[model samples]
Target: MHRRIIAPGALAAASLLLAIPASAASYSPGAPGIGDPYYPYYGNGGYDVSHYDLRLKYQPTTDELRGTATILARTTQDLSSFDLDFLLDVSEVRVNGIRAAFAHSGQHELVVTPRTPLAKGTPLSVVVRYHGVPSAKTAYGFTTWHRTPDGAVAADEPEAAWWWFPSNDHPSDKATYDVSVAVPDGMQAISNGTLQSTSSRLGWTRYNWRQNKPQATYLATLALGRFDITTSTSEGGVPVVNAYSKNLGDNDGAARASVERTGEIVDWLSGYFGPYPFGSAGGYVPDTTTGYALETQTRVYYSPKQFANGSNTSVVVHELAHQWYGDDVSLKGWKDIWLNEGFARYAQWLWSEHEGEGTTQELADYVYASHPADDAFWTVKPGDPGPDNQFDIAVYDRGALAIQALRNEIGDKAFFTILKGWPEKHAYGNASVADFRRYAEQVSGKPLSALFDTWLFHTSKPAAPAARTASLAAASTTVAQPKSWRTIEATNDVHGH
Candidate 1:
């Protein structure tokens, strides 16, 4: 990664320009929260992080992970003190390459005050050194920094960034990452981005990976364990990598096949969702864990359930689709998560149709019927599913239902246009539910407010017009059936957490 050197004169000039009416150089503590209704303390304010250079050394024998996170950020306001959401042990802190006063509070807040006040628009670097045993603490369910049978991996979503390293820890604070992990002699360490280099010395091995694109902290991942690793590239020279636990002695063939199919799925999704959004693509299906698969940027992490049944291949496709919707055009707030899970879940439906299983309408009808009209599933609308119910089936299943409903209402041309163009419009940035409604209306050239109201925000289930859904399924471009595809549509069981 290239280091950015900011000149004093340049920053000073910019700071003066930004401070149109400078009165006094007064500074106060940065806000403890970024004002999300669901998780208030998730992200901090006062500075915008641009890059994270995280160097971590893990000892599986002791379960003790040591880390030093150097965060590069631009000051959004003149600050006396700021906070980073870090949860583990901390020994020292530095601001602008020098030691600074620091304090820890609550469960994950690390407050730091520099010797000198920072001016607005000034670029700064804060290096934090810490060491401790890392543990996964899913505020919602099974989330980030999981402890697998052989080793550990990170898969934080929504609000678990403090489990491994500290950061703004929200989708809105997306930043580029340079993560390097060192493990013991026998164990392998994996993370996002293209592998830059590896070195071994004194019973320790290091693997360095760099993700040059901006990524949310929660989508960041690090898996360290016994993995049967493979390396290759796909269409257009995009690197394809796959690593799963070698411990699955008998099921290795199935697991390997699923990983190898990543290239095929990428090609399939690109045909619909535009070109892949990252420099590399792959997955980590660690054996011996009852966890869920996560779309951790380029590489996803799968649960042991994916190996038990051949049906988990579709789970891989869903997570990969998120590389476009969930990871690329991320949510502006937690309420808009339907933008992530809805599209990914619908992608599974599209795959089901393409491969000669149930058409998307059938899948939608089955999922909607599987949940009774009065069941607890439809109680919380996906557009505003409260924090506790955010991951509920309402988000995944009914969210897909809403998307399919819009697809049928708008016809294939406008629907596919929004699917390919929406993400491209807000590429590498945050989007809200309102943004999607307007886009659907504009592209389709129709009033979609009532459709959005009924399907997304209404408490009651929306009517599924069978004729409309069938028309879409019939008109869609589907290929011949692969003998391997299951006749029954794969259950929406293993969700993308």
Candidate 2:
């Protein structure tokens, strides 16, 4: 996520040469951070998913998932009818351990309703056994292989968690997860949290991962391949595990470096936010052709190429930050994606600060320069589209800038106080822009409504009054050299540090 900085002379020359007024960018209506238009009450009414014990037997030869999911859920409200969204690729289904009636609503979802309604808080357990290959579209970047062209087989993404299990898929409903993934011999299977046990049956090996802490569905991941795993511990004594494909060259050095650094970043972030939100922190570098990485709970998936030139560290920091912002405190809907991306993106600058690599102003200028001053910011209202369109730079970069603006308006002490207080105040929960705005206003004792509206929801970028910009410039001239000022260092050594 980090890019090499341009030389100082080149940056200065470019800054001077490009003094021309920049044009505004357009906007697009996209998905909300959490809720989908299709499922209005997706995460509503807490779900008790403990009744399900899933057994999945994936067949790589035909790219199919032959599995069984036992569901035990209690209703909180009287129901004439009830529905569950089970993301499946094939049509086979059963209920109450029998072949019950079901139908495919669309390419991405399956709808199932029990024959009769149960009373409020009624407990019911149904077993659904299905078989089919999971759709590639379900996965954002990673893939779960059914059958490799070379006869080898692997399953990644645990797409079946959504592809097979019927429950709320959003982060708002944090639930305990127990996953048992069976893979062929010679392949390693990994998932979130701790390794409860491993068992071998037939020709496949079943690796079980049980997470005692509550986790969102998307963060619950699974990967299977011929892996070389290296284990270590952080400075604070937290476990650090790295999983890499056997095909990759000596991963020992890379694994050690990445894990240690990941531990340090986690320690630093926990100091700012709160304790690490999950049970463990690690990275999973699978052998893939893509060039992206994902922050799936405690474990992050990275492409091998990102590690080639040591550019992977930034991605490591970016994803690890999600453990606090995205994973711990989720966005209410897609419209609040800035809640997820902006905070994670800011982690990069925080990383630079921790490394003593750049000044806060320099980082702010870098962000401001890259941000587009246009109506694009509000084009995508929250909860309009879906999750895919939510990953754009506007949500990530511009959103982070808005947070930085807030930090600037309210001194660092109050700003980080809000930041640290959020997850603690609403840990394992959902939050919206309004929730954040109110918290900031309460903490800083400032009427920030104008600022939030102008920066967050307004169509155009907020412009500083001519006088304010002039005053800031004059203030900057009188300040000490930018490089010597340690804003993050000073903030870090506080009580949280």
Q: Name the top lDDT candidate.
A: 1
Q: Residues 54-173, candidate 2, lDDT per residue (tens digit)?
A: 566655455556666666666555533334545554454544444544554333334444444345666756666667666443433433443223122232221324554555555555
lDDT per prediction? Answer: 0.77, 0.58
lDDT for position 247 in model 1:
80
Q: List the residue pairs that clash in candidate 1.
A: none
RMSD to the true structure for each prediction, in A, is 7.7, 13.4
Global CA lDDT of candidate 2, please? 0.58
TM-score: which candidate is best?
A: 1
Q: Give TM-scores for every candidate, taking all chains together and pairing residue i with residue i.
A: 0.88, 0.77
